[model samples]
Target: MQPHFAVPNLAVPTFAPASDAGLPLHIVTERTLEAWLSQQDAATAGWARTMGFSGAWGQVVVLPGPDGTASGALVGAGSPKSRQRQRFLLAAAAAKLPEGTYALASDLPADLSPEVECFGWLMAQYAFDRYAKNTGAKARLIAPEGVDAARVEVMAAGETFTRTLINTPAEDMGPEQLQQAVESLAEVHGATVTTVVGEDLLAQDFPLIHTVGRASDRAPRLIDMRWGSEGPTLTLVGKGVCFDTGGLNLKPGASMALMKKDMGGSANVLGLAHMIMATGLRLQLRVLIPAVENAVSGPAFRPGDILTSRKGLTVEINNTDAEGRLVLADALALAQEDTPDLLISMATLTGAARVAVGADIAPFFTDREGDAVTLASNAQDAADPVWRLPFHAPYEAMIEPGIADLDNAPSGGLAGAITAALFLRRFAGEARYMHFDVFGWCPSSLPARPKGGVGQGTRALFQALPDMLALS
Candidate 1:
């Protein structure tokens, strides 16, 4: 069965008219005066004071009416100029406020853009209650004036899709299921999809992909989807390792617990594709996912075995757990064949990236300084943070194990994320390549982000594409 989750649809009525909106939700900061409280009546102000509400960030207090029923609510907006607070200020309000339709009672700070607030509000309402029952009702917020409601809705929809795909268990989100999701997306957008599965992958020269996935009962496949035929060509490749048992190497129980999210890279790529298509960005878009499950069996590829890649480079499998980069190698080789104007690869490829940048910030690698600068700026603008890590060409020797042109994973374990990027870069050729080593998970809950599958750097790329590709 397909995974089930309810994502807020931005196309519908996202806001209520001020005339009929039930509650007046005030966003207060440390500087906010009690004078605004006077508008609520003496009893409401007294209740707020008794609750010790000093407008600290994310604090919420409800005002009780004379009848002991709810009259309104007050939420902390934090500092007017702090980027961190403004990023998801409304999200806190959306999550904590009682179930009802609420509207903004006070003018938001100039720095707290309406788009950010609207997007955060929509995201905060997300709930992944597929296996469990959610008895509580969700709070609703009216879209503020002058905000692009439709754009925010599309963004929220894309992020919700990403989270849903990543959160589903491995049994339900294997290679076949991933194909189904792609087919569903194609049907919605009038895009075309082609697949090379099982022996077909070998016949088509994707030997590494076949080698890694052949052991699984679920057949592995390469999903190729194409959308739009004009403007600059943009190719996106995501590692679709449905589950990583680490193959012959094997992972400890704790390490494998969340392997279901291994395909998080593919989920995020599809999410970005959704946003691009929804906005009708002027670009010829192609998405490549080497969907596989790195399972163990007699047929599973083992460490120290050398295999020929689609790009004709020999790779020695040093560690089966590093299968993400292996599958991506073949896909990136394919993407570079046409020499697209931009080639981007994203993967949950290395724990070193997590150790360095942590889970919240996505670390990207690229040789283009200008593109790196643009991406950083766009990431900030989108409120989706990304940091650039150097390609570090000197470490290329680490990937060369003498027996083959490349090593699946190098020894010594230093600059791991960089070395993996270097390995993939060999196959990328002359294409303007960008690789994102994303954690693809939120270990804990934040304002708009939940403690599950998340879309890291996806929004940053979405925001940067128009300018990067010179699209009008």
Candidate 2:
């Protein structure tokens, strides 16, 4: 069950009026902070000091009105730089503080984006209780007035759901369970759903998908769910390897700890789908997830194996561990068949991406310049960061093979992430394709985000889609 609200409605927080209102809020920036407190009655200063007014995390200082009653709260976020570095610091602090309405005594730091603050607050309210033997403490924050509470809830809860799904162990997140997860969303949003599984994949011509999945007992499948109509078709494809043991090209024990999040791309796609449908955006939506487990058994597909893809391209399995591209090949082929107006795919497909951009930033590749610009702009506005990496045609040779149509992996170590995108691009055809090689697992707990599976690029994509569709 969802946890109880941390901040109850009876005591929701408010912001100061227009005289103090603006984005990149210096909620407690030094300049206005001292002056604002000085203007308040002596009781305000005393209460603020009592609550630890220096702006440290977990410091719960208060402000009192002229009558000596609590006016609001002034939770300190240590340094202005600290506020920018960690989005959730203030929210987490407010969640555990005594219940009451609290206003931002000053604007947020200039470096802190509005969306960062908004999303951060939502993060503080998160609680994963699905497996909890006993309910834990509820954490809630009052939504600032003028914000769409439901929209905020959707983005926040959707992100949490994505992370939760990816963070769960593989035992609880197999292909079947992945399908069920999508089905649950379909039921809620009235989206149409379909699945192509097992032997039917062969009949339907998803040969690469069949080849790689043949070893797993749970059955490999492609999940397709659709929402919206009467506008540009926006197809979101996700690589859903529920768990990757790296096939016969086995990963070391150390490498396998986070394999449960191998499908982070798929989980994140579903999360973005949730936000889109919740907002009732004016665009047709199609979600495709090629769910499989890259396991090893006598029947597992091996290196040098050649398999035909759903799009009729032959691929040589240079490394069985490179299974994400194989499954994405089939799903992307399917997505391409419709020639959707916009085609985007997300996957935790390459470790090179993490090495290249680190965990916090998602490195994305897109075929269109306009799309890249729009996405980057939206990412800035949404405070969800992504960097555009070229689809670099010259690197296409990395996956070129002498025997089969293409190699599942490149022989050269350089440009691993770009080559992977080029590999998936082979299946994308001429559709305006964009791909995100996301690091699904967060390495450690940060202020707003916990250390676990993360849905890296969904919010930026969600924020951009509306405008992308408008132009389309």
Candidate 3:
């Protein structure tokens, strides 16, 4: 079944007109708000003091009306510097405030740009209502002055698309479904798409991809999409393991529980693509997704199997569970063959990445010093946090297993993420490459970010792309 490609309409909290808003919402910081609070009605000031509502970050308190109805709300935003560093700080108000439209009553901090406030409001309103219903109405906020409403809407749409793709179960989001989604996106943006599927992958020299996916009933494929023709080339490769049952080396029940999210890298890549196309960023963009399901069957590739990659390197499958890298290897080699100006590969490739950086922060590996510095700075500026881990040349030996040109999984298991990256780098060749080891699942809920499939590193990369490529 071809998956529907219509961009899902996110329930962005409505932005009411100032005249129609219900009550004043004062977002005050710790160091700059005592005098402002004292100037408020005496009764409201007493109510705040009685409730111990000092302006600490994330604190929300409602003021009482003359008839004891909600008069307004006071939210604690931390220092200007701190508030500027985080995204969606006002989400606490959106999630907790009484269901009514609120307007910003006081002057916002200089650091809190209109874009930040508007984007935060939109993000705070996201909820995954695919399986169940979200019947509760969310509080509305008036769009802050000087904000670009259209830009905010586009960003929200892109993020919603990503989260929806990741949160859907594997049964509904396998290889075929992934292709449909890509086709849908391409159709919307007037981009061209091509796919090499099933036995044809072998014919095309993508042996590792076919070998990993051949066992599944749903035929595996490579989704290639391109947009624009007049700018520097930017190629993105994502691991699209729709459902990783770990092939012949099956995962435990606990490990397989969330395997549905293994395709998060592709989902995020598509999300970033949406942002670029929607905003009309000038670049020649290409996206390659090696979509597959690593299932166990009589034909499933097994351990110790030798598979030739598209780059002509032989890989020794030390562990069938290490299938993400194998599929990515072929796609990466294909991407490098073009020698694009910039190439990025994203994957839910290793658990050690999660152990090292936790779920919220993504870690990236890159050999380009200037690109690394640019990405880190843009991540901070865009409020999408990322950390850099070394490519570590010495660990390259860990990927060589003596028998084959590379080992999918190395022994000792130290720096698993690094070893996996090294395995991919062999195929990336000399292209300016960056690999993101991302945890696409958000295990716990935060203010605007719910507990479900999330996009990691995408926003950071999106924000940095133009500058990194010198297209800005």
Highest-TM-score candidate:
1
lDDT of each: 0.86, 0.76, 0.84
- lDDT by residue for model 3 (1-472), tens: 1112474433433456656856888888898568867788888888888988878777889988889889899888877666655566777667778888887787766665556566666667777886788532267777767766666666666777788889888888999989988898899888999999999999899998999999999999999999997889999998999999988888999999999999999998998888788778889999999999999999999898988889989989889999999999999999999999999999999999999999988999999999999999988766677999989999988889889899999889799999999889999999999999999888987766888888888878877988898885
Rank candidates by lDDT, best first.
1, 3, 2
lDDT of 1 by residue, 1-472 (tens): 0122233221222445546656778878767746666676677778888999888777889878678877788887666555454468778777888888887878876667678777887888776767765322267777777876667777887887888889888998899988988887777777899999999999999998999999999999999999998999999999999999999999999999999999999999998988888878889999999999999998999998999999999999899999999999999999999999999999999999999999889999999998999999989878899999999989999999999989989999999999999999999999999999998898988878878999999989998998899998
Query: How high a TM-score does candidate 2 get?
Result: 0.88
Rank order (by TM-score, best first): 1, 3, 2
Q: Judge candidate 3 at residue 268 and give its lDDT.
A: 88
Candidate 2 RMSD to the real structure: 5.1
Candidate 1: regions farther than 4 A off? 1-22, 38-40, 65-68, 80-87, 135-137
Model 1 residue 413 lDDT score: 92
Q: What stretches of model 2 exceed 4 Å from their correct place?
A: 1-26, 47-52, 55-71, 77-84, 99-115, 133-139
Better candidate number, 1 or 3, judged by lDDT: 1
Give the 10-residue window scoring lowest on summed lDDT in candidate 2: 1-10
